[model samples]
Target: MLLADPNNPTGTAVDLDALEQFAQALSPECLLILDQAYCDFADGERAGRGLGLAQRLPNVVVLRTFSKAYALAGMRIGWCAADPEILASLEAVALPFTLTALAQAAALAALDQEAALFAQVQTTVAQRRRVRQELLAMNFEVPPSEANFLWLPLGAGRLVSPSGARGPGSACAA
Candidate 1:
């Protein structure tokens, strides 16, 4: 399965046992493509350390980006972990020079502060909890979010934002 953001507008994370079960079922037959673009915020317990599923499943593919956690949106820097066959397929279809020299350098630089970055993520988690609690107090059907942005299920009030109803395919860019 090609999963982007994994959960949804709900911001909920797939439980570890659930994900592992899903992967184990498909192993040796299908590849589990897990895209964790907004994973840092959703992993409240940091249960996956970002790769819990891929780590345990042989056919699982874990894709991650620096845009969310490391704040490297413009660089388009991300990595995919998969079996050798999938990796080769990806390379074949990937565009040449997909990343600029500067982008490459920046990703390398970001790696130097992994621990500090992780600490910040922990701090962000606390903030998300506070924000969710505050919103819930207002009677909004806000689910506990795992991403930087909260998931306002919106319910019958799905049409939010000052701009009126965002189209089915549109997303809140900010």
Candidate 2:
């Protein structure tokens, strides 16, 4: 089973308790992959919950990326946390030297600047909240979001042209 903790588009995050319940309910043969790419934008405790689960549960693997909060998208670097045995099996089949030397160096440097990077994350979270609030006030049907972006469900509605004209057959058709 694969789940994004802070799901894309909607940005809703599953709490730790619910995640724990999911891990417990799954069969031992089933591997649960938690994609926490936007975790840094989420609440502090919730951010680390997937890693904790990966450490405690053999069948759980938590995947994180440097692309979003760390601002390292071009480097294409990410990591997975899972049982040692599972990691070893993955390492065995993995192609050698997939990461460029420069990318490795950048990832190391990013780790060294964790405090500043996470402070930026706080700024982003605040902005996300502000944007969501504004969208809500406009009656855009915005859902609660913990990630950097907001999802606006414009069901049956057509986007207005730059000239403020709604096309024929649009929901705004007169």
- Candidate with the greatest lDDT versus the true structure: 2
Q: Against the true structure, what is every candidate's RMSD? A: 4.7, 5.3
Which residue pairs show collisions in model 1? 41-146, 42-146
The list of candidate 1 runs beyond 4 A from truth reads: 43-52, 156-174
True-structure lDDT of candidate 2:
0.88
TM-score of each: 0.80, 0.87
* Residue 88, candidate 2: alpha-carbon lDDT: 97
Clashes of each: 2, 0
Residue-level lDDT of model 1, residues 30-148, one tens digit each, is 87788787787656454344365666666788888889888999898999877777789889999998899998899999999889888988888888888889998998778766677
| Model 2 CA RMSD to the hidden true structure, in angstroms | 5.3
lDDT of each: 0.75, 0.88
Query: Which candidate comes out best when scored by TM-score?
Result: 2
Give me the overall lDDT of model 1: 0.75
